[model samples]
Target: MSAHEDVGELVPEGTFLRPDDSVRRFAGGTVLVGGSPLWLLKLGAQGARVFGRWVNGGEALRRNAGEQRLARRLLDAGLLHPESPRGRFTLADLTLVTPVKDNASGVHRLLEATDELSERIIVDDGSVEPLPEAALRHEKPLGPAAARNAGWQRVRTELIAFVDSDVVPETGWLDAILPLFSDPEVAAVAPRIRSRPGDAPLERYEQDRSALDLGSRPAPVRPMSRVSYVPGAALVVRRSALAELGGFDTRLRFGEDVDLVWRLAASGHTVRYAPESVVWHDPRAGLLEWMRQRFEYGTSAASLSARHPGLLCCAKVSRWSALSWGLLASGRPVTALATAAVTTALFPRALRGRGIPATEALRLAGVGHLGAGRILAEATRRTWWPPALVAALFGGRARAVTSAVLLPCLIESAGKGPSWALLRLLDDLSYGAGVWAGCLKERTIGPLRPQFTDDSLCRGSGRRLPASRSIGSKAGRTCDRSRSSQRYERVGAR
Candidate 1:
């Protein structure tokens, strides 16, 4: 399907959109500077006028097909976000499916929380005591993916909501999410998974940074994006889309949700993360349980990598960024500084016609390098920690470098105190150990691989924008009747 059709023919009227904070207007609002990986979009005069109208009104109005198309492009570019949808859907249109093993109390809590939903089905995956409320039962333990497939297969509603037994959704949780389904392209949407409140130190830590929590940002869920995947803990999906994909893969005992989401995107369907909808999930019973959960999560990397190749990459950095960092790490400070200077100088030359100032180009280069350092540090902690720890134990220099790499993690737990830092270290170690174990078991090192991208900039023009009303160019001439007038130039990282 075409990209336009994948996102929808037109963004529905009355959809509220807000420009991303990073978006900056230049050249009398004709040029836009922002998006994931960042880019420069040069709009035609008419397109700019339509954008200006949306910017001023804070809502998308269907004045013409051109305006709707422009709004859709900005949204797909990540430059604009839908603040809310004017349409509404009800719980009556949804069937709740819960997969459980032995958490009857959790089942009770979940049922109590979502009492409004009439069609609730529980899949009992071989619990010691069979649940009387179970609509489907397995004789032996099948993983969550299998159980969910079983439950959702029997669902007859237009929407199927797969909410884990452990979650208790907050009131009005559907208000922000149900409206999103108005876009037929949106296959699934997940809510923010927050840890249930508690005073224990572990509970406090989990509350602050739960693995399931995707933060407070609304984003189109895609691999390697700011928000990659959402947990299946609380997700509502269109019945037809899930059926089209044949539901979740039962082979993946863990990370099945990630696999399902990537498959949806691969199949040209949209998945989204809506943080405005909140669902409370109970944390692990204790520290060991928590560590085990983290370890299990890490183990899924190998299988996920096998399913979707480069998406599991530990880090992706530009050649210049990698060279500069490598030189610095190898004790060549002077050479590293020179490399950085050369990179900054070349950045502006590459984007010569984009109208960006030389100083701004230098700033972007610096920001890119800093961002690269953070990515490398995270990669070290997440995938290379085993080797990093071994190196740290032998030499003072190695220890120093490892300590520098670990500073980010410490800074993340700053106000939480030294004890929290220790937990953070343990967390990384446990997760990394699981990664190593999974790699050995699967005999694949794909997850450990780092992807390097070219630093050179490339620009192209085409009639790639969705078709609609003709937009007038800067020269006050209407576009060719056969093509679109929405011209854009990609400026920064790929």
Candidate 2:
């Protein structure tokens, strides 16, 4: 089926849609800016009118096919999201599959929390003490991916919920997530995994910024997007989709969840991150364990890069932004300012006919550069820190750049106190060390590569518009800018 047909099927009648937090309307609501890598959408007279109505909290009903098509287009572009899923399926259609190792106590705790769910299966991955409640057991300790595959293979339910033994689902967690299965194209949906509450300092940090938690925003799971991959600690998957894809890659002990999510997206299936459905996960017992866990996560980067090349990168930035930062790092502040000014000047020119005001264009360019700096700094700390540390030791321009990169992190944690900042530093170092180790073991530098792209405004105009012919028919033929603006005003006024 065509991409449009697929999206159309996914967004049926009665589906409530909301714009992404990144979405911003300009040019009297005729232009939209949002999506991963940022983008701009210029709407015609009728298109703007329809968009305004729906964006102002109206539903995309079947009666207005134009609005529905527009919603579909925006959704596919990642500009819109399903506000709340309304699925026909119930808990009876789901089978909860928990993969356990030697943590029988954890299994018991999880089972007690979810006792209401009758269809449950526990897969014992060669635990020293066999779990009496386990429906499937392995003689040898298979990795989590293999154990999950074993459990799901024996399940007859249409949907399978994979909750790790270490996780405990919040009450009524499925209420918000189960309905997402109403969309046949969605292969999986993950709940937000928050750290279990505790008074320890490390526990507090984990609660504030757990790596497993993908923030509170809802988003379609895709590589390079805000929520790139969901944790396997708790997620619901369609049995058919898993079977078609041959389940997770058992070869991978780490990053199997990321690999599976990426594969599902590549095969034209949707995976969603539903933060409204919360689940609690126990943080590693102590600081050492926490650091070890972060390191293991970093080690997966090389394997993930091997499986999906180009998707794993240290950083992605625009050429101009990179040049500006490079100039600043080299002590050419004046030159850096000039370069930034030039970039801001070009933004309006690139989007001259897109209905975005010159002021908004300039603001977007500035904001883009600021965001790029953050990305570069994060990359330096996470993947490039080893070389950065070496350069810092030499005490030159590299030292200055390294200090600049680390300053923001320290300042952000300042409010929390010295201990917090120290922990944050350790966190980055541990992860960066693991990344280097993984690269060495795999004999590939793919994970360390940086990606640079043309300015997003220059690329946004090329995005395909669904039912363009129909939209053109309703909006009338485009003319000069003056005429187009007048038409937009007329439609927007209504």
Candidate 3:
């Protein structure tokens, strides 16, 4: 029997389909399951069909020896996993928790949307008006983090779900997300929050693309990856797990979700973003509301940086790339070019432990810098134009840069309106402003400071630390991913 060979196990009943994000088919009969965990397959028609069958929920075929062997290959390739028994848990196993301030209509909407559960608890966080019949009132307005703690405390269920009052979970949301906890190490899972469409442009802007919406990608919620934070808007958490960690931080007024997820990751507990299990959220359509929300979000950066000193920077991106981005943003095309050259020239020092030749690494770094330069320029146009403007006026460099920026906008936007690049710029600026504000308030440049990761980071002990402890480590010191955060209570993030 192979590593995945388990005769007693049943196929995963929940959301277990093979994600199609990185499956590539070529002119030859070769396929690659390429992303994160990567694999290559030189498949004949029969092999291809076999792979498709498993992806499409063909568990019955597992009885056959040939099919089981093929399945083992798939599992080893990081293409699929055997479904854990759904009998392990159900909708009734998790308790529902909703925290509210004064949104009676929002609470009503949430109550209506949630499905069958053994227990549903609502924490009324300092609501001025009389409480709704369904709510569990708390006289004082504890922030969301504290409110969540209050709700989680009353229930003794195995799992506790925290849903923001404004969110309405779609049908099948539980069945789709609950199975993720089959891995006992998984602390929590959050569903994607889709924006509810509004009458106005900003509202419509949010509907198509909300700041909270993290898109359809199943990713480990870690420090610097694509899916970093799982929003507290809709979460299904293992009660024992949160209980051991002391629940949500009462100090966090905003970004409690980020703080919780990051803490879990650092402590070696797994957190996943399940985009398939979705909820509709009422977005801030008004400009003032949006601005206020983003600014508040920004202020949390200083706090998070202070808490997790070494974890806030880009984990995998090279410094050359970061410098190129900044230089391009400031309109210094020459300086940006020189910076990339210098970084490449010092490849021995700049690109150590990267496993690639210096020249090859330099080329890769250059290409990445060029791409980021365009993005930074667009993002900075609204903030400030730099000395590069004078150079752009003179030569073909201006035309070349303009074409590079506009060409991508036209192609990627695909009629989505106002180019995604421009939209991204606006988004970054909003968050950047808040970061600046927070820095000003704290009288620190921590947010702007870079915290680079060393590939060779280790624990105080001479032995090499496990991979989990490394990615999960703060200050690049080896620590158990699932160990208690109590020892480092201040190293929390949002």
Higher-TM-score candidate of 1 and 2: 1
Q: For candidate 1, what is the lDDT?
A: 0.79
Backbone clashes for every candidate come to 0, 0, 5
Worst 10 residues of 2 by lDDT: 485-494
Q: In model 2, which residue pairs have backbone atoms overlapping below 3 Å?
A: none
How does each model score on TM-score?
0.92, 0.91, 0.68
Regions of candidate 1 where Cα sits further than 4 Å from its true position? 5-8, 458-486, 489-494
TM for candidate 1 is 0.92
On lDDT, the stronger of 2 and 3 is: 2
lDDT of 1 by residue, 1-494 (tens): 22752335666667777777778886677778777656677676566776776777664566455566666667766778775555656788899999999999999989999998899999999999999989999989999999999999999888999999999999989888888887766889999999998888888887887899989877788887777888998999999999999999999999999999999989877787888899999999888988998899889999999999888888888777888888887779899999877876766666555556767767777888888889988888878988888898988877877888999988898889876787787787778778888889899998888888655541122111223433334322333243333445544453
Point to the candidate with the largest TM-score: 1
**What C-alpha lDDT, on a 0 to 100 scale, does residue 86 get in candidate 2?**
66
> What shift in Å separates residue 78 of candidate 3 from its native position after superposition?
9.0
- Candidate 2 versus the native: TM-score? 0.91
Candidate 2: what lDDT? 0.79
Segments in model 2 whose C-alpha atoms lie over 4 Å from true places: 5-10, 63-66, 455-494
How well does candidate 3 match the true structure in TM-score terms?
0.68
RMSD of each: 3.5, 4.8, 10.0
